[model samples]
Target chain A: MRHPYADLVAHAAHLLAAAGLDGDKPTVVAERLVRADAMGHTTHGLALLPAYLRDIGSGAMTRSGEPAIVVDRPAAVVWDGRRLPGVWLTARAVDLAVARARDYGTCTVVIRRSHHIAALAAYLTAATDAGMMVVVASSDPAAAHVAPYGGKRALFTPDPVAIGIPTEGDPILIDISASITTAGLAARLTTAGRPLPGVWALDGEGRPTDAADVLSTDPRGSLLPIGGIDHGHKGYGLALWIEALTQGLSGWGRADGEAGWGGAVFVQVFDPELFAGGPAFRRQTEWLAENCRANPPIDPEKPVRLPGSKAAAGVARAQAEGLELFPGILEALVPWAERLGVAALDGRA
Target chain B: MRHPYADLVAHAAHLLAAAGLDGDKPTVVAERLVRADAMGHTTHGLALLPAYLRDIGSGAMTRSGEPAIVVDRPAAVVWDGRRLPGVWLTARAVDLAVARARDYGTCTVVIRRSHHIAALAAYLTAATDAGMMVVVASSDPAAAHVAPYGGKRALFTPDPVAIGIPTEGDPILIDISASITTAGLAARLTTAGRPLPGVWALDGEGRPTDAADVLSTDPRGSLLPIGGIDHGHKGYGLALWIEALTQGLSGWGRADGEAGWGGAVFVQVFDPELFAGGPAFRRQTEWLAENCRANPPIDPEKPVRLPGSKAAAGVARAQAEGLELFPGILEALVPWAERLGVAALDGRA
Candidate 1:
């Protein structure tokens, strides 16, 4: 059954606050997570709360902490995440970056010691909505779940990067992990009793395996890079650069370092007005978007789509008909959420 | 056959000049092209001489012109390529970007009315060698060859972006097209009597086709994006953003526009000293690279290699035993080289 976005947000916020998180951070995290669900990325939505709670309970990720400025400049800022929730820190970073870009035309934020960022599009929506172009990348220092192109042992963690463009329609977003699949998806599939596509993950012997549970658990099977075997170098190269841009620039530890878990993040924001008027940037993008949509489809019955169109559509549909959640989320959250006295998501508590 | 880098550059220079190119610009083009060959991307190397001549002959690309500043700022610059060789314009842009980045800590350059840039790595090598990180993206204004994820008709080119990280060893370069394969590769494979892997392209009728020649010719079959069907949304998103950054930001036409041949480019250079010291950045990257190299191999017989390590090795080998020419290149250039009175590539006329 579908639930209102606001109710979902409030429900998530209540659970987060009750889990020992302090200040106004819970609201921000809730909004980001609900937005993911709203956009049909339920893997990054409420499913993440359990992990966040676990991290906070173990003191691996602090529930009540703020990022510290490591370096501050008009064009660049470096933030140490201080083990805070990435949503909280990233929201603040986007604000700071947009503010800085207004004056400097471009600004970059390198975040060290950051926690899991969930979905990159959640952070980017704010910046793109503010009429700035955003590019962000993140890599976990320790949570290695992906092997290098030909390597058996995991040295990468999908190393995602995302870019957003403010447009006339919904903001255009390109978010991708360097690996063919993400650890989160593996976990979700495992929970749902599904086998992975045959080429996606490697087992203990570095042979291809379809066991989602084996792929998701600790000492898990490793994810293949985006191109699988033949073109893995492309994805591997992207992952390496993301790692460098995040860790190297932030002075964070390498993936193999002892300090594992919450790692590094890199963000760069540019004011389109720096190069052209914002309107013109929007116009060109709109024109391109129009053409992308108008392009004839291979299946004549199906229309072409611009990037982010589906996610944007998902948001609208979720608003109208409520979110079609990935199964098992509410089931998973219900048990822990009871401790917080947060009862039914239907607001019957 | 082995020829000195200097001789190869000179041979390329002579051919370009003989095609009615004026001034010393041919040397710049030659250097970039030869660098591509040295790095083993021979498709972008001497093999492109015939196209250059044809472009100049048709006045689609001018043999001699200079990039004029469309906008100038300490932190950003926009150039009008004036149909000059993209090699010349890109080299100039790189110099200006590196110079400005030294002062501003970060700098961006956008190029309009540009020609084929050959290889992004060539322009990147200089900045990377100079101890700076560079990000570059380019898209053709009208040379559409890739289909949007759901579309049959072409709405995007390869629309590649490349990043370079200066390191203690080989600069880590990650260059990729938004599509699985590039137009150049399609052309090469067509000439080589090869069939594309089944999923690579869509025929004129929008049916999947394996014939390389069919994909490369006019009314060309459209290329699938990097992710194939299952996740082409990711690649289409990347292409869309590259289009926005390069064409939208540069005030250039979208891929659907009439202005064709070559299009626009975006380049940003960052001095690591902006936030952290360059030495620290290099050290961290070196550490990461070493671990990437030492990662346990799936096939223990073949050790893992870091991105760009193979290309760097190729360059070193080329320096020793010469750049491997695509089998047909020197033969293709022989008649033109004789026309330009430039002979003796490998001491053979």
Candidate 2:
């Protein structure tokens, strides 16, 4: 069933408010979740609301509080998210960095202990809309699903990074993980008894395999890094840097001990006006985007597209024609709506 | 034949000085080039000196001049390198950024129109030795050898990024490019009448192939991004970000028309002490490094090593013994050495 974007957000926000989130946290979380769905990141979208509500019930995610400022420099900041909702915490951090960047040209905010931030791309538009470039990266130190380059045992998470660049037209939103495939997709494929599209995972014995179930086996197989078996060292290096930027700069991570369902984040915003004139920056990016789009594709029927072009188109369609929740997502949230005594999405006015 | 490290640097510097580089520029270029060779980056090492001499002879590289400061802020800067030696210019930029990062927590310097920066890793230790984390990336707007994700025609250079993270032991130095392999390797393989190790490139029709000569074909094939065909969008995104950070930030790029064999570079330095405190940062990174090393390797005979471990060992061995240039590198420079009336490596003291 398709639901209006506004209705879904409102319903989700109401359920979240009833569950415990205070102030504007419910609205912020709801909007970001819905936005992720609109952008076609089905796994990280509204499907996560049930888990978030459960976290709230168990007091895993802090309901109402401002992140404790760990360090505040003119151009840099460290924030203790205090187990707050990652969606809200990350959004707030981007805003803070954007505002501060005006004065300092560039500003970076590192957050420790932020509860599972959903869909990094959802938070990028806030910066790009303001004609700024932003970079966001996150890692869950308590969870390890990826092995280092040559090692078999898991030692790191996917370590995703996103960047937002504003051109003359729609902004370019880049969201990528250090690994080839994410844990969520792997689990989904395993549950469906489907093999991966390629030999993207390694077996327990360190041989390449297409079996998603390997991830669940004893001495579990691990997801391959972005460059796969041949050039995985590049991905390994990228993962380490993400770890340092998020966990190291935040001053808390796996070395400190396991934290439940939480992650460390790094957010940076740069004002092009402060480096080169904004016009010149946009002019160069616009040219590149145009040329990239014009580049001849191998398949004549399929044209080359920029990173965010498809997502942007999806968002426009969702906004105009309403959104169709992936099967089981809305149904799963219906029970949460009932338990919280909030109007179900279907019952919305 | 192996030559003493100091003797190689001195001989290279003499050749560069005779070729036209003035003051400390020759020594800076020579040291960085030799350091790359010591670190096992043979392609980017002394093998590039002959090209540098040729660029100098053609007046493509400015021998001596101060860069024009385009923008100078407390935390951000832009420099017009005016075709200056990128090796020296980048080294100076790192020093400037490191110095400014002390007062600003983080500092970034973008250089436009710089001659080819030899090796990104060669410029990392200066910042890491000072207990700072540094990021360096470069893109030559004049060159295009790597194609966009879905496109067959080339739209980008290799677009390399390097990061240096300080730990209690050796710093983790990561140097990677957005492409699966570089044009240098492709060209070398083509010249040797050899195929690539894997299908790391695409044919003109966008079919994956291992033939390095495809790159020299009429409708030239292009190098694949790091993730290759299956997940090249990630690498394409990385390449775009590197372009934005280096060329977009510098306000001079492909859109401004190609100006010979030069590049735009981005350098950033961050002080851990300014955020979570240096001790805490190191504690976390050190733990990660150790655990990664101990993780069971796929092969018992080969243990998991950090990114820079092998390079560090190579440098140590070179210092203790002598540096060995690639077989053709010394011979390639002999003609230039003789023409410039400089003492050759074989006659070094």
Give the clash total for candidate 1: 0
| Candidate 1: stretches off by over 4 Å | A216-220, A255-260, A320-324, A335-337, A341-344, A347-349, B18-23, B63-65, B216-219, B338-349
Estimated TM-score for each candidate = 0.94, 0.99
Residue B207 lDDT, candidate 1, scale 0-100: 73
In candidate 1, the residue pairs with backbone N, CA or C atoms under 3 Å apart (3 or more residues apart, or in different chains) clash, namely none
Residue A48, candidate 1: Cα error in Å is 1.3
* Candidate 2 per-residue C-alpha lDDT over A217-298 given as tens digits, one digit per residue, 9 for 90 to 100: 9878899988889899999999999999999899999899866999999999999989997888998899899999999988
lDDT tens readout by residue for model 1, B245-271: 888778776733557478689988988
lDDT of 2 by residue, B87-154 (tens): 99999999999999999889999999999998899999999999999999999999998889999999
State the displacement of the C-alpha of residue A252, model 1, in Å, after optimal TM-score superposition.
0.3
